[model samples]
Structures are given as structure tokens and as C-alpha cells.
Target: MTESDLTSNFPQQSGLPGEKRTDELGMRILKAAQTMFVRDGVDAVSMHKVAKTVGIGQGTLYRRYPNKGSLCMSLMQTKFDCFAEAINEYLRDAANATVFERLSRVVSSLIRFSENDLDWLKAILQSGTLKDAKANIFESPPFLFIRDTVQRLLEEAAAKRELVPLDPAFASVLITSSMTPELMFYLFDSGYTPERIAERYVETFLAPLFAGAGRI
Candidate 1:
């Protein structure tokens, strides 16, 4: 689906015209929930505390989300539009690059995602409560946010012999393997700059993968 579709479907709390009609009270509840979910784990946040935080009653919180998982899901959905835009922007910016350049940037995008959007991602990955929400095996992953864009590139890569012929999904996963911030986190905790790791990543893995890859 287009980013416009994601935007239209998952209405934000930041005053979209048709998104929810946010009165001051609803906005307060939303803001409070964002703070709570980011600050505390989803399981730890409660309806009562949400009510207290927004100066509303438990009845009011229920008016928004029937339960905590749904409430937090709503919070995540709210953030999806902005995240989609950022990813699409990066993909567009890399559009004119060579296949290898695009793949490198997509890997870079994954690492940036892990570092920038850690808390919301942690909530989604850790919480299975939202699994029934029209889910996919990969939807909950922040990487899957850009899955279509990356997957199509993989398909073309295999078609053109850019890399060894592989399943698009597997190739995409292979390209992203161990390029996470968790890997970077280890590097950082053990003291390595993001730049050094990225340079090493390209030389060690990416260059060989696409040495003479061309359009199919």
C-alpha cells in the first residue's frame, strides 16, 4: 500500500482533519499515553494511571481503547505514518545510486531505524498482544516497514545476477543480517563509531555481493 494509504488508515493524534476529532481531553489522553508507553513498558502501564495522567476517568480511557494492548497498538499506529515517510524519503534519496549503493543505504536505514526508533520497536517486538491486528509474520518489524521497497530491489538483483540468485525475501534478510543497532550497540558499548562499522560492513560483505551487478 502507498504511504498515503497508511496515513489515511492510521490517523494521527496530531490534528488530522478526519483522524479522530481531538478535543483537548482526547489530545491530553493521547499525549499522556505516548509519554507512559515510551517511559514504561507496555505491560507496566495501566488504565488507571492513564486516567490519572490525563485527569480523566477509567471510563474515558476505555472510550479510546478497550484495553491496554489495543491502546498501545493505537500509539504505535500513530507513529507509523511518520516512520514510513522517513523511510520512503531515504529510499527516494538513494534511487539514483547503483544497486550496491541502494543496498548499502537500505542497510544503513535499518541501523538508523534501530537506533532512532528503539522504544516503539521494543514495544512491538516484545508485545505479542497485538498479533491479531491484521498482522503478518513481518509487519511488526520496523524493517518490514520498508519491506516492499527492499524486496523489489532484491528481485531485480537476482534477475540481473547482481548477487547469487536467491529468494527475494531471503536475499533481503541476508543483506540486512547482523547490521542492526544491537550489533552497533555492542560496538558502541565496546567503543566503536557508527561510521567505522558501516565502512567495515560495506567492504567485508556488500562489495563482494555486487561486484559487477548490473540492470537485468
Candidate 2:
């Protein structure tokens, strides 16, 4: 996505009460933080260093992003927005594709997104941001977008009687849970490449669920 798209997707209420900053400044901070994080690793970078790099006061940076977790979350949000848009665009353009094909691609996309943003995700988790009600990630916009998309596709397959009768809602929740950062990290630690994980996920989960249709 473009810089504007990232900036547009930035959370307005990311900081403490009454925390406010211009979009331009927010984008600048995000860019600076991301650069430092990518160059030095999230664990090595400090909020003070980020402010120094951005030529902003530490207090100003703190007001906009109370912690590294909040900053990482904002960065992840931008990536999530791009991920959501890519899936939507693919679905729209793949109107001729079978529900099975579309679903597989969507699942693959989600896997890739998780793998690509693993660093930021890990940082966010370690930062204790996930404990916040406002950052309850499962209910976040981008995650919900993908989860609903997956459910809708499952519902479509069910409607056509192409799959075994199943509860799409529960199935979607299960499938999305598999792709979470924590699970993905475990799979990675277990020596699973992203490609292998996607393939195995489809085979172990989707193939059986969709067995009735011979989509596998």
C-alpha cells in the first residue's frame, strides 16, 4: 500500500487519553520506528532512540505512542490493511475461480501475511498491548475482515452443498486461530516453512472439511 494508505489506516486512539498528533507526524514516527526496528531489531530499539531519529521530543513521541507495542501495533495495522485489501482485490478479480480455489488462495494469503509480519507481531505481544481492551486483536478490523471473508467463502461452499455440512462460524474461528502469530511462531520453531505450513494446513484442516466436494 502507499504511504497515504498506511497513514490513513493509522489508529487515531493509539495513545493515552487526549493524545493527539497530526497524520503527517504520525506517519513520520511510524517510518522512523520501522526503520530503526528493521535495522536494529525491535528488542534493541528504544522509544527514546526512535524519537531521536524522528527529531521529535521524547514527550511528543510518548504522547503519540506510549510504548513500543503501540508503535508496532500501528505498523502492523498498516500491513494488515494492505493484506486485507489484497485479499479483497483478488476475490473481486477471481470471480471465475471456484470457491475452493478462492478459499485456498485466501488462506495462503493469511499465512504469508502472518509470516511476513512476525517480528512486529512478536514485539506487540511482548509489549503487553494485547492485554488492552482497545487492542483486543481478534476483534480488530483487519482480522475481522479476513475472518469474515473466510467464513463467507465457507458458507458459499456449504450453500452449494459442495462441502460437508459444518458450522462456518465455528470453523472460521478455528481456522483463523491456526494462523495467529503465536501458532505461526510455534510452527516456525518446529521447522515449518511458510509454504509447508500453508500446504499442511490445507491438507490437515481444509481438505477434510471440504472432502465432500473433492476439492483436495
Candidate 3:
């Protein structure tokens, strides 16, 4: 799907106090952060720098986002919302598409989004504040959404005898784990293009699950 298609599906929220103003400020902060992140490396874009760039006080920034990790989470939430919408739309309109085709599209879309915003993704994943000892990455909204969606798709494919009999839950975990942010970055840095990575992943990992259904 196009970037415009993904963005146009982002949900419009309301009901909170000063919701409009809050969203406005949040957008301003994200824009300032994105600019700094692109000009400098993610490591160099401090919360102080972001606040100063947006012409806001440190306290005001902290009130909205207690740390860089919080800001990054907000940024990721926006991207994930768009992503989830894209997946839903594809599933709705592509009823005639094979389960493997639908699954491949989801994987391609995710990889493209990551490559397009690698810097922000790296920053978010590496942020010190996000390193909570008790936190489960699988429990995060984005991860859960992806895992559940993939599992559902795999289950449907298996039901139709399009895929070999297997545990959808385990397969979904395997798929998502292979596409973690760190692994994707490493592959990119090691001279693998996103398209090549996606192709290889489907060939080596997903294609085999289809038994004799052939390559994706």
C-alpha cells in the first residue's frame, strides 16, 4: 500500500480534555524530533534538544512525555496504528487473494515501514528508559497485534489445507521474532536490501510452511 493509504486510515481520537491542543503539540514535538533525528543520529537527539527545537519548556515536554522512550512510544503508536489499518484494509479487499499472498503483503508492508523509518525505530528499541526488567515485548500493543493477526491468518490457511498442519501460535512467534527491529537493522547494515530480506525470509521461513503450495 502507498504511504498515503496507510496515513489516511489513522484513527481520529476525542473525549480527552484539551485533546485538540494536545494532539497539535504532540505533532509539533514529533516533527521537531524527526527533523533532529534525520539531521543527527538518533543517539544525538536528546529530549532537551527536542524541547528546545519545539520552543517548549523541559517541564512541558516532560509532562507530555517523561522521557525519550515515551516520545518514541508515541511515535511508534502512530506508525503501528497506520500499519494495523493497512492490514485490515488488505484483508477486507483481498478476499480472493490466497492466505500466503495476504501474509506476504503484511510482511512486505512491515519491512518497508521499518526501512523507511529505521532511525526512529532504532532509537525506540535502544532507549534506556524502555528497558524495564519485568516488561514483556510480546505483551506490547504492536507486537500483540502483529502476532494475533499472523496467527489468525495462519490458522485460516491451515484450515483451507493451503498450509501444512502446524501450530499457528508457534509459527506466528517464529515469524515475528525473525523480523525484530535489531535483526532487520543488522541485515540492512550487512548489505541486504529490504526487498532481498523480505524475499529471503519468505523463501526460507514462510514458503516451506505451505508444503507443496510452491514459493510465495
Candidate 4:
């Protein structure tokens, strides 16, 4: 199926009481799966293992997520949504300032989030990087969601004359590629202060992006 068709199938529902319950259950299942995948490998973590970790029967896991692909897709989507919500919330509540101020706040929040989820993210990123892997996890809805969000903001910034007129797609890739938590983990493994990494990140990537654009 096409991307639009695929996206149409994953509806967002959470406000209703029933949806809230499902949301809670989904989160529990996702966390269990994440733990298992991190401790073991993605291929090693089965629906049965996730069910066992969540203290539920295999039937329940199957009922919720019929297959491995579906489970992984849902798990990534849920986790990414939650992560993005946190950043969006921080941006919304930030003190009155320019959009640049809000972006700075969100970027710092992202750094903190990466540090908070470092272990699991590190493991997953390393394992998921294998070229032989069957599933292209990065091509899933979750990644697309984040990419789109970043792209939208880039487009908005350009339209408002806060940033130069560049292709939103390339800007999205640049932002995400530069700030990816896994990159920071790699940098640390190679020996660099996270503080320095973050500082240079803004100075190098972000500062240049805005330099050529007119301010709103």
C-alpha cells in the first residue's frame, strides 16, 4: 500500500475513556517490549516474551498486536508520540520569547530526553542499524511523524522569514540527523563532553540554519 494509505490506517485516539484504557494498556505492552528488546535483541523479543514481561497471556498480546511488525510499529509510534508531546508541551509553556527561544528550549529538552533514555536507545539504534535486518524500522510511521513535525516547523520558520528558504525535507534531515540521541551516544563513546557536544550542536548546526534568513 501507499504511504497515505498506510498512514490512514493508524488513527489517533485517546480522549475517550475506552481509548484512555487502551492507551494505558498499549503503553504497558510497549514498555515491556522495549525492555525485552534492549536486554535481548529485537529479533529475540517475541510477542510471547512481551506478554510474559507484561504479566499477560500470549493471547492478549496477539489480540492487541497480531504480528511482530505490527507490534514494533505500534510501539515505536506510541513512544515517539509521547516523546514529541513532551517537547511540544515544553515549547508551549516556555516563557514569552521568539520562536527561536522556543526552539532552544525544545532542543535542550530533546537532549535531556536522549540522556534519560540513553541505554535503551543506544542498544536499539546499534541493533537496528544492521543492514541485513528484515524490517526497515526507520521507515515506519513514528519516524515519519517526527520528520514531518520538524519539516513543518522548518517550513513555518522560512515562511515567517526566521530562516532561509531551503528545502524543508533537507532541513528536516539535517536537524534530526544532527541531534539524534544515538549520534550523541556515539560521540560520548568516542570521548567528548555531552555539554560540549550540545553546545557545538547549536553553534554549528542551528546557528548556521538561521543566519541567512530574515528575522520575523
The candidate that achieves the highest lDDT relative to the unseen native structure = 2
Task: Write the residue-wise lDDT of candidate 3 on 155-179 in tens digits.
Answer: 9998888887789999898888678
| lDDT of every predicted structure (CA atoms) | 0.63, 0.82, 0.80, 0.64
Please give the lDDT score at residue 72 for candidate 2.
Answer: 95
160-196 in candidate 2: lDDT tens per residue?
A: 8878889999888878766778889999889999999
Ranking by lDDT: 2, 3, 4, 1
In candidate 1, how many Å is residue 150 off?
1.3
The window of 10 residues in a row where model 2 has the poorest summed lDDT is 12-21
TM-score, per-candidate, Cα-based = 0.60, 0.86, 0.83, 0.59
Q: Write one digit per residue (lDDT tens) for candidate 4, span 1-216.
A: 222333333445569898788877776777667667656866777677788888888888888876666666564554556667666676567535666556655566566556655554544555443334336545755456656767866776777788866798887766765665557678777877656676767777666777786453
Estimate the lDDT of model 3.
Answer: 0.80
Model 2 clash count equals 0
Clashes of each: 0, 0, 0, 0
> Tens-digit lDDT track for model 1 on 78-179?
665566677678768877776677767766655554555455555554555545744454555555656666677777677767775457786566655455
Can you give the lDDT of residue 63 in candidate 2?
Answer: 96
Per-residue lDDT for 114 in model 4?
Answer: 63
| Pairs in clash, predicted candidate 3 | none
Comparing 1 and 4 by TM-score, which wins? Answer: 1
Candidate 3's TM-score: 0.83
The RMSD (Cα, Å) of candidate 2 is: 4.0
Per-residue error for 88 in candidate 1, Å, reads 1.6
